[model samples]
Target: MRSSNLLKRAHSHNKQTLSSLLHSRGTSPHPQPDTISGHKLIEEETNPNYKPEHWYPARIGEVLNHRYELLVKLGYGMTATVWLAKNIHADGQSGNRKYVTIKINVNTLGEDFQKGRRAIAEKLFSANPQHPGYAHVRFMLDTFRATTKYGDHLCIVYDVLREPIDLCMKKFPGSRFSCGKLRVLLPALLKGLDYMHSECHVVHTDLKPDNIMMGLGDPNLLDHFVQHEHDHPSPRKAPDSHGRIIYTSCSDFGESPTEAVIASAKITDIGLAAWGDEKNTKPIQSNVFMAPEVILQAGWSYPADIWNLGVMLWDLVENIGLFDSISTEPDHYRPEQHLGLMIALLGPPPKEFLARCAKAKWYFDADGQFKYPKYVAEDCKFEHSIHRMNAEEKDLFIDMAKKMLTWVPEERWTAKQLLEHPFLTKERECYWDTPSLSRASTASVGSLIPSRQGTPGLGPTSVPNGSIHHSSLPVRLLELVPSLASSDATEPRLQRQSTNGSLKASENDEKSTSSSTLPLKPKMETLAESKGESNDETLHKKRSVSVNKSNESSQAMIDAILNRGKNHAPKAPAK
Candidate 1:
């Protein structure tokens, strides 16, 4: 007993020493008043190496101010391209690789809808604003690069995140994360969402596993050898001669004293999210986890965010999305399954809510008339997949999940309510703290894949952005052909590059490419003038001229925006 007590005291003393080490660096793992004050002193600096390329930035060869070499393409969505890059700035002095992931969104020829969303992202980014509750989502590096696919797409240089959370968990399947870590990440995510909803008044509209990133454990995704700063810090290693280490760093751009306070995952991809899209009044992206109120065109609010948060929480706790309905038609996605999920867990929607759904044709109408179907199938049983769940577990998921994913947007759990839920409070385990979390399998999602047919509404008619002209997600793309190598998929795209940075489309690309890859109709005016079908589209648009040179929303863009306003002037808030 005496020896055991000595051991306990030794552990305590060592922990205190580690705390002092971190504190001496002026970096605290947790936000204490004194540490928080220190953060205010870190100022943004101009990295001499930063530069923008005018060419269609693809592959690792595109020029980034002629310093950082784009290495490997990490991932790409319809509109964004993620790449693993190496800092040429090192001049090979350290012989060590310092890597960062660059998220590039090309600005091809101007399309009103496309440009509008880009405009919002640009405006928010240029302001370079930070919310106290969020982890600092700094524009670590930025540059403008033109691409033929869209005309010059704005390329944003950011510190790349390491890997998918699922991939991380798989590596340590038997490991369990501690409650202290969950305390760190969940509050950060909530802060990001909260910032978007209240401060920016925009909804992410898309939140899923792939979008969330991890700092250490899964694989050194950002560890391209050179030192890089990421939101999540990497474990400390013995210092090298240069006094720098690779892989991880930290930031608290958004967090305040409140752990659950929402932060800035700023409503990105404005091509799909409009400022006044109160009712989801227009077309947008498709997928599971998107809230029903959003799909039904039934006037969504911050609650749509709650639905997404619920989906995230459930998956973290049980490793399964509550409803993961994929389809082959209209781009193989569905959100209507949310109703079935709702019904199974909370029982049928109240008649009044059903009435609201019935009147909304584009979202829930049957007969394949509108985009998504309204009603649930008869056998829907909202059973969660938590292995041997007891009654209390059922209450945890069914009650909270249902509350967050409720039919009436207003009825869903507010961010505050989600914080109060038993599931979040139950054990304090975080996805990160799980020791065996990294060893889990990616294929073993708790929920089985749903049928390809569910709700309606097609994905964007044109490729969204950064979506390879003919490519699906990289996961789906790689899966389509078992034998093709990841590098092989990119080789073909690189072969067509012009000596001067243009990608001369091959005869096959011209024919097979979706219409979105083609150049826009000749603009009678400059990019800003020709931005929107009318001004209404501008809600999602963010137009920027080379600010180092001029200031004013372009005439053509302004005219197009005004024109769109006539078609759908946003509905004013209800009394």
Candidate 2:
């Protein structure tokens, strides 16, 4: 079967299974309740660290900036609550209603942090908007402040997007992306990273699955979502002691996305991003994906993001972290263990590299031997870990991984260089274009624009003007990589030799290929449609909803909650 057909079948099976489950439970697939008893814990209220006062008390129907109207809760995090909102005052010339995502920050953040965030946002906005990778980035669109009795809240806006990539991965079989999907995803991801590193001079310190979100390919989907919410308001918890009503977050975007929608995935959550020039030892990145330099307190720059992405690929493909042994307790991070795993897989770091690390002495002795040598797991070899790919595919993937996972940050491939890897381009051709299966090509155009009532995942058929050709990439960008060229000529100093007395093909390997022919372009519609803040903070895990309650009983519970709220005399809406 063709890959596209397989994807469609998978989506169909998932939808059918969901419908069956909902039917078995005697409830609608999209259930909306007016209210639930405040006694019932939901979402953020269940968070052990949740503080009511720290959060902005945003109501479902409340209007912000006299323009955007909050429709429903989308998600929440440590720092803010995200809402799907409708723009009441869109550009009159277009006469089209626009939907946007609003991230309302908590009031508890310090003034200095707030100012720094604003400064970073400004720097992101100043990046070359014309860059091909610009569309692949979830850039901030607008910002304003909302005032309340508790404190002032910062409101940042962005284009309405679907669920994060991490959630999307669950829909796929084996909880991993198909090679076809990876081909579409990785190139776009790398392009966005390149734009951040080279054109914007920004380093996205956080590059995990949660930070990458699937873009809504059709604007009509947003319209449908808004109409759905208007017709059926989401169920909300009754007024709490402070009159706070928490609504069940509705993050689903109706149906499963087509390959094109998946292809349009964008890198998001620049909240932890920093300027590349401002290299500092301040610890950043999620603990598992933390680069060696970061763990060692060695100053890092854009190359750190390459290592982060390299580790993240395992999560995307293997459905588990590559460095699972880094922490003995699931909640606690062990730097020594992580370094040990790195050494076991990639061999010992060079003495020169360790010399720059402030914390190297804590783990390594005077001669550079790991003090805790027992921590190194001999079986933790990269070749032995990957089980899914064929030999050819595995070879290409390992080569790409090695390029990005080096101990010396400078030895890691730039995002642009990785874009040309055979794992993405050549493997895509072999998988998608096999002669045995005949169908319309499923290859992505590497760019997308919103279309009205289009086929699933299909974007505009023609490239827009000002589309970027690979050949047109500036020479200076290529010239800036003298270290990579020099490093490629010699064997990598850090690679471990296998017991067979031969080094793995992943180490110090290079393949010469024709220049990338992929046509790159900005999403023209995104420039206008995109708006919103990054909800990059850690979010509370979603609790499963029970479907056992009958509609009549549910209505009765809502009515009782309403009567209870009335007796207490809930506070009036804010002005």
Candidate 3:
């Protein structure tokens, strides 16, 4: 009944109630035990009260704006909690207060949940540098951890959205909005979506009505998001009949929002959002909103969200889902039936795709189902007749949806491209004006630590550790030897010549000292006026190729002296 809070109460799950079926006692249909059982349905993420040791607690709510005090324990789940209370004070002013929503520790929902949510939030913020419209998305107020009575708690504060989209659609029919409103809303959705794709590198896998909510307005077209970091942009106030700032927000990330919500889209319900490198939040099930590729058990890509967009658009543009899974026969889930939906709309799966699928034995029939003339499943032709609108509107919406719903993932239109399409072009400039898809966005990175390098789709795989990488050899050697002009080992050659010159100079000095008895002028002049035989320039220029030991190291020079066995090179007895 209360749509906004009902769907937003994702972390607070109610245990199942016992109906009349449980009334079995002695005279009743079935016997009952003393222990009572109520529906506390749980899967991987059950509402956990378990506190592993060393996992301590800390208070999240601290110095606030003088009035509001966060009374703990509104609700909690596997990952986080929702706190409810009335704000009584203000930080800068001795002021009055109101109630709001505070969601905490959103990351522990799982690695994927944390990664995807932060990925998009960062993406949106980065995409539109100065837009206040995106400010409403629940993001970190500030982060700090401390010990308390419970355990570890990660926290965030948020504006509590009082109403959700399903209730909006229920309360106000198609008459509530018009072509004008859709023009603005569609591009907004695209801007948000484009930020997620190019900037965040994430996909909102689940989309439905309940996730969105009307923002701070009397409920008209002027809606936008708010978060701690986003300074609610100076309002461009367009008044509804009651004259209020039309503000709206997609409430949760539990699932991806459908594209049709360009008119009434709300992003909420993030419990099933993609986690880790994959959408490992929950097990796959038979859901109508899933793309055909998911149905075929093929891996999901970022484009999988586009198929969801097409389906959502189909629901809004026409009053029906393009592929209604609820009505699907059990057998329609198989490849041929899966293929049937595409044929009915996009026409047969491209022949190239069939050829590819043919090689994938697990997806096809083993006994030649494709070759049989009697094969109804394989050969059945699909009727793609459109009776809804005149040829133009039908062709336009259908063609656009097809681009968003392509079979091959690479061919699918990204949110940025979709926002730029004719369906949304009326407001394309408005969407691109703020332009939320930026290259510098950090969506492409998961963690700054060097260790997070390769783990599936987070980015590309890393090269092995042992790669020789010989290209760096010269560069590295140059770091050690600043003057090496070629592959010839210049330092070794120079040292070798220095040793030989020194030894020869010593001999000449001894011979000339005979001048102490003879003349020392000849040797002293020779030393000053003439370059020795090993001119440094001549040695460097020579295209010499040899591993001369004496040239290679001082150790070789020591060996030469040892061969002479020291004894001072047999100095000519004091002349």
| Per-residue lDDT over 1-575 for candidate 1, one digit per residue giving the tens place of the 0 to 100 score | 00100001111111122223344433445522212222121111011221223224353355575766765444444444555667767544433235555656534435685566565556445432655433433233555564453356656566544444433343333322223334345545665554554455555555554455544222332342222222112232232333311111222111121222212222222334455233354433344555665565555545565677676665665544556443424444444555555555555444445455534544434442323334454444445344434443444445455555555554443443343344443332211222221122211111111111100111111222212222332443223222111233334322222222323331122222111110111222344456635432431231111000101222232233334444445778999
Q: Write candidate 3's Cα lDDT for 277-309 as tens digits.
A: 343323232355566556544456555666776
Per the 3 Å backbone cut-off, how many clashing residue pairs does candidate 3 have? 44
Alpha carbon lDDT at 366, candidate 1: 45
- Runs of candidate 1 with Cα error greater than 4 angstroms are 1-62, 87-99, 106-115, 122-132, 136-140, 147-151, 174-184, 216-271, 276-279, 325-338, 355-384, 388-394, 425-575
lDDT of 1 at 287: 47
Error of 2 at 351 (Å): 1.2
TM-score of each: 0.48, 0.69, 0.45
Q: Which stretches of model 2 miss by more than 4 angstroms?
A: 1-41, 91-97, 328-331, 427-575
User: Count of backbone clashes for each model?
Assistant: 80, 6, 44
Taking every candidate in turn, the Cα RMSD to the unseen true structure, in Å, is 25.2, 23.1, 29.4
Of 1 and 3, the candidate ranking higher by TM-score: 1
Give the best candidate by TM-score. 2
- What tens-digit string does per-residue lDDT give for candidate 2 at 281-353? 8877877888998889888878788898999889888855799666534357778888889998889998977
- Winner of 2 and 3 under lDDT: 2
Q: Rate the local accuracy (lDDT) of all candidates.
A: 0.39, 0.63, 0.36
TM-score of 2: 0.69
**Stretches of model 3 off by over 4 angstroms after superposition:** 1-99, 104-155, 174-181, 218-286, 317-319, 325-339, 351-360, 365-392, 426-575
